[model samples]
Target: MFTFPILAVHKVIARGEADAAANGGFRNPWYGTRPRQGEKPGLWLVGDEGIYIISNGELAGGQKPLVFYSDECHPKGDTDWWDYKHRHFGGDDGIEFIDADLLVPSFDRNFGITHPGIRLTENDISFSLITR
Candidate 1:
């Protein structure tokens, strides 16, 4: 399986009432505790091809996120990219947060210009594709 790193750019807040319906109100499991302010959470993307970041107008609303393959910047070396994997993800593969909007960047594009959205519920976060 091919593995890629997924980073959540933004802070996660509590969705208050919607906590129970989300992904079991689970916080990011990668860190022992919640990340400090301005800290971006990350996960590993493991699949045959790759993953896609989608979004609607709102945060974490609209459609569920989807994964697909692309001929983009797929870094698979033991450099800073690999170091990031080891540092944030313990060198393993996985996925997290709530209430807050998640800025997920496309594997091929620059995050500043284009990023998908994910809404954080108390329990879970869902992905939506953003159209330019």
Candidate 2:
């Protein structure tokens, strides 16, 4: 039996209805530009989509991951941070958000984006968001 490892990831800011979560994140960060060695994760606006997560190696490169989790940069929101994950990514976990559209890479890695009307649940792990 070959059991794939579960690489869970979450964003920093999660406001709006998502304010319930202390940070709306349960794991690491990965999004924006060329990911740093250990940079924190976050998205654009608050609760942009539904929060992003990638497991089963959904976002990985040639051992040169472009998305990684950091502990730094956890900005506080004026009225409570509520945003989605990064959109364009190049790693095992790419999470991003956009106001126009989310049909890009981030949405692929994550089943859905974070938004005032969106939310992340255990059911997210029910399906594989990565492409074959």
Candidate 2 local lDDT, 2-119, one digit each (tens): 0111221232222211332333322233343444322323233222222232221122234221222221112332222122233212112323332212223454465543322223
Scored by CA lDDT, what does every candidate get? 0.32, 0.26
Worst 10 residues of 2 by lDDT: 1-10
lDDT string, candidate 1, 1-132, tens digits: 122223332211122213323433322333446454323233223311122222111124353333322123235433344544343334444343222323333434554333344433346545554444
Give me the overall lDDT of model 1.
0.32
Q: Give the lowest summed-lDDT range of ten residues in model 1.
A: 49-58
Candidate 1 positional error at 107, Å: 22
Let me know the TM-score candidate 2 reaches against the reference structure: 0.16
On the 0 to 100 scale, the lDDT of residue 112 in model 1 is 39
Winner by TM-score: 1
